[model samples]
Each structure stands twice: as structure tokens, then as C-alpha cells.
Target: VLAFTATGFVVAAFGQALGIDTLVVRNAGAIILCLVGIVLLIPRLQDGLSRIATPAAAWASRQQSALDDRAGLWGQALIGALLGIVWAPCVGPTLGAAVALAAEGKDLGEVALVMAAFGLGISTVLLVIAFAARGALARWRGRMMAAGGRGKIVLGGLLLIVGIFILTGVDRQLEAFLLDHLPDRVTEWSTAF
Candidate 1:
């Protein structure tokens, strides 16, 4: 996850250096995220994807096998970097704004720190879910199986809502509101990180 976020930061910096419009890239990312959520939410979309899934899966498997045989830890790192590109949409809008700030000649260290924090936050949640929630996940998996993909629907709804919020600029408003309401010290502490 650190690798993923770092890759994103590097890519954004490179893009900015190249005179690319980071805002446009960010908007495109939001659209991609929305499309992913929509695909998950719509059954027909899933059905359409399923048609291509087999061939895609076969090719992916073959690639994975080759990577495993040839690359070891480096292969995993490469995969993480690739995932960073594939999941750029998953980076919250704050990072997008941060990238913009960097492009505007604000401190690059601040942007890197934000990306690191974002990566850590995601990693922590995944760790907690993987370790602390193992038993709960097992039970939830059973229930999900019985529920005929209610789980997917619920997750999809959440992703869709978040995507819409980010795309519509509601997230920036929320962030501003929070900053306005929160203690200065609290905000400072986050920056200190």
C-alpha cells in the first residue's frame, strides 16, 4: 500500500512536471471510480463483465505464474505499483487537491506526507480487517453466501455514494466544513504528521 501511494505521488509529480492537467486527471479518476461502483451495483453490468472474465482470468493467471517463477519479491512490488495505477481512482479527492497544490509550487513534502498518511490509513484498515475481523469475516462470508450477494450490493452502494460525493465536489465542501469546525491544534497535528 505504501508502494501504491508512493507510486501515485511520483506519477502525479511527474505529470505536473510534464505540464499535464492534474485536475483533469483527477476528474477522470473520479469517473472511473464511479463506473466501477456502477458496474458493481448493476446486475446486467456484472453479467456483461462475466462474459469476458474467463479469458481475462486465464491471461492473468498465466502472467501471475510467470511473474512468480521469475520475479519473487520484486514481482510483488511491481504488482503493487501496477495496482496503484489501476486503483488511482480509489485515492480520495484530498490527494487530488494535494497534487494540485504541489503543482502550484506549494511544499512537495506536504503532498508526500499526505500520501504516506493515506497509505498508512488504508493499510491499517486492511490489517484490522484481515486480523481482528477474521472470525467476523468467516461468519459474514457464510451469511453473504446465503444472502445472494447482498454484501456486494451494500459495498457497491457505499462506493457509489462516495464516488458521487467526490465527483460532485461535495467532499471538498465537507473537508472545508470540518476544518472550519475542528480545533486548530487538531489540524496542525495532522499536518505535523
Candidate 2:
């Protein structure tokens, strides 16, 4: 978890572009994310997974559920980390595009610094969403339960958009916009630190 972004930074430092592998990872991750969202949103698929669980090992499923229940916040944190892992690839194109821009006519330290910041930003968002949403959902259990199915479907559609964008190499437009809008002071600070 800690080294995930550092790995990206190191790669950028080496100027090694695993262009195809990165695309593969981004696409596969997107597809899997969409599938997860679909399974959660679709009653039929959800029921099918439950049915599959039953024949595989009824007691194991129940025991796992119990363990999840008992593990509480720690379990939730682990799940959050897993979610971050799954979704990390969705941001790959953006990060890569950003790092490349930052690396252009720059030294290795500068490239790494940019990538490290991007990685921290990505990690922070995932962690915040995971923890904050958990609390919010607990408070709004009834409303959330009602909207949960629809939410997952919306999320799935969003994932598909991100996936398609990366696959098509359209994320560079977003990267361009971000770089254009980034304040000069921020760039100065990034350089200074």
C-alpha cells in the first residue's frame, strides 16, 4: 500500500514506459471495477453470487460474514485498502500524463516529486472516501439502503467512462486542462520542496 505510488515514481525516474502493460492494467482494473459495481447494483447477479456461495461452502460463507462483523473497523480499513488497489489503475493515465509533462526538460528528482504528489493525492482521496462514506452511510442507513442499488449502477457507468477514456488515450485532455489551470505558486512550491 505504502509503496504503490513510490513504484510509479521509480518507474518515471527510470523513464521506462510500460505503455501497453499500463493500458492493460488500467483497462482490466476498470472492467473489474465495473463488474463489481454491477454485481452490487443488480439483484440477479447478487443473488447468483449468494447461490454460488451456498453450494461452495455454506458454513464458510457464514463464518466469513461473522468474521467481517467481528473485525469491525480493521476489516473496513483492509477493504478500503483493497478498494484503493482496485481503483488505482483508473487514475494511471492521468498520473502518467502528468508525470511525463513534469519530467519533460526536468531532472529525475523533479519527475519523482511530481509523481509522489500525484500518488499521495490519489491515496488520500481513496482513504477519505472509504472512511468518510462508511460513517455517512451508517448515519443514513435507511436512505442509503434505498439508494444503494442505484448508486452502484451510477458508479459502474462512471467507471466505464474512465476506462474508455484511458483505453482511448483521451485522458490527456484532462491532464492538459489540469496543468493549464494549476497555479504557478503550486508549481513553485512543488519545486521548492
If scored against the real structure, what TM-score would every candidate get?
A: 0.72, 0.53
Which residue pairs in model 2 clash with each other?
none
How displaced is residue 42 in candidate 2, in Å? 3.8
Native-referenced Cα lDDT, model 2: 0.65
All candidates' lDDT scores? 0.76, 0.65
lDDT of 1 by residue, 165-187 (tens): 87898988998999999999999
- Which candidate number has the best TM-score? 1
- Model 1's alpha-carbon lDDT is 0.76
Candidate 2 lDDT, tens digit per residue, 1-193? 4344555555554434544354465577767765766676678988898898886687856755776899977776666566545444556554565457545756766655665576677678977999889878788999978787688778767766765665666776886787689998877785563
